[model samples]
Target: MIKPTEKPTVTLVGMDGDMLGTLRCVEKALSLAGADSEYLLKYQNEIIKDDLYKDYNRLLDVTRKYVNVRRLSREKDEEEREKARQQRRGERAGEDYKESGFES
Candidate 1:
């Protein structure tokens, strides 16, 4: 899995610093665009038919594995965060129960 530090830091830009779209990588963008060829063609023609798209495509080719790794890493991080949060909640509940002084 791609570490947070290892993820690519590229962002697609337009004329005068206007943001076009945020791309994780080429494969990610294509996946998001969906499996329909018509849709893919339209997207290429409408949104990515420019020098920026060319650069994104090149980057995607090089970083496809890195993108997948990053995705897995992110999912793992989220799961860990959730487990920690749940543990904290359980501990808080235990403390509350003790403070309530409900004898068995």
Candidate 2:
């Protein structure tokens, strides 16, 4: 049996379309509201506000979604690995049985 730690690590980066749309709306609102701001300001505001600055509920929801996605992906990877391992075991067992003159 392969240890969990022996499995290759999977990394995922997800961006919610709704979250992106909300950001675009925010940017458009800011742009229409007053003088143009620096690109860095927009980027900083988006990151800080999403992760740290504001809307605790929204942050939790996004975090939950991200975590769920990663969890599902990892589960799928493990399932595939298990299936492959089982297939190899079956093949080896079949070869052993044949070598023992157990043909039917």
Candidate 3:
């Protein structure tokens, strides 16, 4: 079986609808916003103090304009692999039949 070390990544877009970095960074940033009233309140204060929240709003804006994508599964690749495996099996069976002087 063929396996990939990492999942496929999607790209993020900027305010100008230009390509940004990988979605991994975006996910990391969102995860850093830990939950809790104090943390949330502190975040609010920081947002108000330096307009940090605007970046999230910018992200939302981009999301509204375009679809966000993610890797659902590696099943499609696995299916292709199964097809290749079946082809190899068929070839081997055909070779075996030829060697045995039998119609298969």
Candidate 4:
């Protein structure tokens, strides 16, 4: 439910459960990030290289409702996992999942 934001954090949280919603949310986020469509396209071609844009299909995964396709990348995946591990070991006391950057 936490739509991805334009903050300078590692993850962009604006993905909706569905493609259409996700697109809209991502567009809004990009807009808020102060990027126009053309700028974003250029950035995608430059900053956001192909490695971070991997396409993953999860149509058979019943647990997922809002999303089926996702971007799979090893770097971000490991970083988030490590953060989660640290949180489990009690990094930030009384912090919620979102506050601890665990919501995806």
Query: lDDT (CA) for every model shown?
Result: 0.46, 0.47, 0.44, 0.43
**Candidate 4, overall lDDT?**
0.43
* Candidates 2 and 4 compared by lDDT, better number: 2
Looking at model 3, residue 46 earns an lDDT score of 47
Q: lDDT tens digits, residues 71-95, model 2?
A: 2255676787789899999999999
**lDDT digits (tens) for residues 24-73 of candidate 1:** 24334555534344534543454455544556444344344433312224
Model 1, which residues run further than 4 Å from truth?
1-72
Separately for all candidates shown, the number of backbone clashes (residues 3 or more apart, or on different chains) is: 1, 0, 0, 4
lDDT of 4 by residue, 9-102 (tens): 1232333234334444444555565656774455345323543233312221311222233443567777878888988768445466558777
In candidate 3, clashing pairs total 0
For each of the candidates, the C-alpha root-mean-square deviation to the true structure, in angstroms, is 14.0, 16.5, 13.9, 14.0
Stretches of candidate 4 exceeding 4 Å from the true structure: 1-17, 40-104
Question: Alpha-carbon error at 1 in model 3, in Å?
Answer: 38
Worst 10 residues of 4 by lDDT: 58-67
Question: Which 10 consecutive residues of model 2 have the lowest summed lDDT?
Answer: 1-10
For residue 48, model 3's alpha carbon misses the true position, in angstroms, by 38
Instruction: Tell me model 3's lDDT, rounded to 2 decimals.
Output: 0.44
Query: Could you tell me every candidate's TM-score relative to the true structure?
Result: 0.31, 0.32, 0.30, 0.27
Runs off by more than 4 Å, candidate 3: 1-73
Q: List the residue pairs that clash in candidate 1.
A: 2-69
Q: Which candidate, 1 or 4, has the higher lDDT?
A: 1
Clashing pairs in 4: 3-14, 4-13, 4-14, 17-66
